[model samples]
Every structure is written in C-alpha cells, then in structure tokens.
Target: METLRLQTFMVFMLSSCGFVLSFQINHLLYTQSNPTAPQTLDRNDASSILNSNFDSSLPVKFIIHGYRESGNSEWALKMKDELLVHAPMNVIVVDWQDGSSGWYFTCSANTAQVGEDTHLLISHLQTQTGLSLNNVHLIGFSLGAQVAGNTGKRNPSIARISGLDPAGPDFSGKGASDRLDPTDAQFVDVLHTDGEPLWQGGFGYYEPCGHVDFYPNGGTRQPGCGLVGEICHHMRAPAYYTESINSDCPFTAYPCTLGQESCSTCNGNCGFMGFHADKSQANEVFYVETNSESPYCRG
Candidate 1:
C-alpha cells in the first residue's frame, strides 16, 4: 500500500513538471465595520493594517482556501460571515488564488511561501497594532490547511489552528517539519473527511496530525455525499465546520481507539467537535456522527 501510494504521488508530481509559477499571496481583512468590502492588507506597509478597521482587542481569525480556490470563494466568505456572527473578530482571508489554480504539485509547493508570507503579516500586525499572537486562530481548508501548518511551524506561539481535511498528496508520510503536525501550534485540531488512499479516490491525509483529531463518520466518506464522490467528501470538512460556528446542536464527539467501530459512547471522555472543540482534549482521537444534510450535528 505504501509503495502504491508513493508511486501515485510520484506520477502526480511528474505530470505537473512544466507548470510551476511565482506566487501572489494577498490578505483581505474584514471587520464588523466593513464586512463585505474587504480592505487589502500588506505586510510591507504598516499603514495597511493601521489604516484599516482591524480591532486589536478582538480575536483574529484567518481563513485560508485550498487548491483551485480563492479567499473570496463562497465557502470562505460564508465562514467569515459565520465567524463574525458568532463574535466580533479581525477576520483576514488569505487569498492565493493565482498560485492555487495551477497544477496540483505547483500549488502544493507554493504553500511554504504562503506560510512565510502569513508569518510576516502576523509579525507586522503585532509590531504595528499590538495584536497578540495568542488571539490569532488559523482556519485553513485542504491545501490551505498545510499552509496553516507551515505558518504555525514558523510561529509556534500561535494560539490555535483548525485544519479542515489537510491534503494528502506529496505530504502523506512527510516529516512533521514538512507537514501539519501537533507541534505546529499551541493547539491544533484537525477534521479528516477524505482519508482513504489516493488510489481509492481520497484527497486527505489519513493519520492524525493534530493535538486532537476528529474523524467524523470514519473520516473517509461522509453521509449525504454519496453521489458527488471524493470532492464532496473532502468538502464536507469545511461545510461541517462552518455550520459549527453557531450550531444549536453540539457536535459532540467521543474518544475512541483508532480503527474501532461502534465507539459512540461519551464515557465521560467527550468533547465538542469543530469550532467549539475544547483545547483540553489534546492528544486524543474522537469520532462523531452527523446528519445527511445541513445542520449536520447530531448533538
């Protein structure tokens, strides 16, 4: 299985040999004052953050998109909206669509620079606005999740990182320094939605790579995504996380041994999944079930 996966990864990289290109990373800030019209943030310009509506007192949330997606994508925007509704925050959408839309390998390679750029932006924000790194939370999906990991690796003081189905290709068996792992942030939580082998049509890493990992519906395929296939399963990570922002039903998850089926009981070892996941539940793996449609939490 390992050999087959490695061979598949090699083929993917070789297929994109001539597609590498420079990256253009952008940070678009949205506050309660300007929720729709995002102000562009530049790490090179201190005034970009100082002149904007960013509130240093508010917790900051950075939303990052993955391969072939932009910060302005519907899902990213929706998540920003949900987060604002939940609480006042300095929301920045990291936009790297130009780099993200190319061949998969090129996009994957671009994540390192994105992470560095983000770290620079955060450092600039702190220097200019007295923004506390402890108040910063990174929420990244797919390749963006790996980007988040990279940033956290550089800035380990970051408070929390929520990885939504981190990409598997070229990163599945990489060292912790090369991919998302528990050491990336003070607290890292991951939701695995498409963890089956690539040959089997999965798009996400299968092993636990966070302080706490949530495997919803076994983490390979999700309910209600039967017709749409792997993409649907992968996308469910963000969908479920967005709904969790203000979900009336708690995404209650119970600790379970890896590969154990029917491990549903709380047994005094449960934690809410998604946005409200408890930081105290570190180094554990949990499982939860969801509904077939929206408002997926089963409480």
Candidate 2:
C-alpha cells in the first residue's frame, strides 16, 4: 500500500516537471550597513558587488529559499535579520521564486542552474573584492538545499553547507552528483525534521547525507506539529535554525544512532546542533529534543 502511494506521488511529481517554464534568479544583498532595504547584486557587474555596501572583510552567508518562496520570504528575512544581529556579515538571499512556483520537478531541475549562478556570483566576488571562499556558508531549505549542494559541487572549498530538511522527492537514492552530499562542502551539516517515507507524506530526505546529520525528535512527525502535518515538520528545520542564531538557549545534541534511546556515555562527544554545530565532528549523527512552540531549544 505504501509503495503504491509513493509510486503515485512520484508519477505526479515527475509529470509536473514536464511542464517547463523559464525562470530568472535574483540575489539580494543585506549588510549591517543596510539591513532592511536590500541591494540587488549582479554577478556580471563587479561594480555592483564591490561598489555597494558589501563588506569584503566580513564572512558571506547565503540564505536560499525553497519552492514557492521568494527572497522576501518571512523565514529568509527573519534569518537574515537574526544573522546580522548576531554578527556583522554579508547575507545574500537567493531568490528564485519565479522559477520555483511552477512545478515540483521544474523547481528541482532548476536547482542546478541556481547553483551555477551562485557559484559564478561567488567567483565574481572573489575576483572583485578578494573575498575568501572559506568564509562562505550556504544555508538552504528544501529544494534550496539542493541548490546549495550544486553550488558546493562547483566549488568544493565552501566552508559549510547547512541543509535544512533537504527536499526528499526526486533527490532520494540519487548519487552524490545528483543531490546534496557530504562532499559538497568542507563541512556539511544536515538537520532532518521530516524523514518519513514519501507515501507517509514526508517531504524531507530520510537518509543522512552530510558529515554531521542532526535528527530532531527522531526526524519525523516533530512534536507539537500534531494536526499541522508534514509541512509543519519540514518548516521546523528553518525555525529551529533561525532561533539558534542568537537564542540564549543551546540546541545541544548527543551522539546516537538513528533510533537509539540514549547515549551510554557522551563523554563530551556531543555537539551543538544548529548554528553552533561543530564542524570538526565528521560523519557523526546526533539526536536533539525541542519544545513544541517557539523558543524551541531546551539547552
């Protein structure tokens, strides 16, 4: 029964991609100097990047939104604000809603181009301002997470790539070249909030695809999401991440297998799950518990 449902969903998603439409991507820049109003960045024009309020000395962070979302997405904006508040840095929101809203497959196919475009923009920044790619971090949600992976594939030196419940459809069972993988960045941290099978209405990838995969609440049907369903569980990835930016509470996670109840002895083997996740811990899986409402972290 589950297999039948999953096959049906896959057919629908694949067919949806057949109806193609052109899409244009935009990069919106926000710096401490200009928080609210974003300056449009043009990868082709060096002056647009170097002449603007962009600070080359600061670290560069890109927030890539998922399907049906724009650069002005509330979550993206909120994250940008929180990041800026936490520290002075360059936050670029990758807006590709024009291409994302058409179909799931279309949006999935477009992630490659988005990644290519982002890579070009980063190269331009490097050439123009001597920006260090090591200081670059890509934070993406759903399909946007795949976009980050594509970008990282083009430039493997990226410091970090955070996959916030990376979209599972069309990406599952694919090779490293096809979807987000551990090799995409120097340090890849994945947060899996919705890992149930597609037949079960899960929208997030179930398998661990990063160097450090953090599965909160067993990575499926997050607590307090009750009647809200999969979307709620999927969006929790970003909500938790955004709060981790400056929250006094810590999202501390303990090392454990996927369904392990407790760590026999963590012995300092634990790592902070969200913004403060330790990059040095490689190929580690951790479990975290969170509250149902805002201020989700339990410390």
Those runs of model 2 whose alpha carbons end farther than 4 Å from true positions after fitting are: 1-18, 227-229, 261-265
Task: Look at candidate 1 and tell me the lDDT of residue 151.
Answer: 97
Local accuracy of candidate 2 as per-residue lDDT tens digits, 36-140 = 999989988777887798887898999999987899889999999999999999999999987777678778888999999999999988888889988999999
Best by lDDT: 1
Return the TM-score for each candidate structure.
0.93, 0.93
Candidate lDDT values, in order: 0.89, 0.88
lDDT of 1 by residue, 175-258 (tens): 999999889889999999889877666789889999999999988889988732337899999999999999899899999887
Our model 2 lands, by Cα RMSD against the true structure, at: 2.7
Error of 1 at 197 (Å): 0.3
The TM-score measured for candidate 2 stands at: 0.93
Query: Over the full model, what C-alpha lDDT does candidate 2 score relative to the true structure?
Result: 0.88
Give the count of colliding residue pairs in each prediction.
Answer: 0, 0
Candidate 1 residue spans exceeding 4 A from truth: 1-18, 227-229
Give the C-alpha miss distance for residue 247 in model 1, angstroms: 0.9
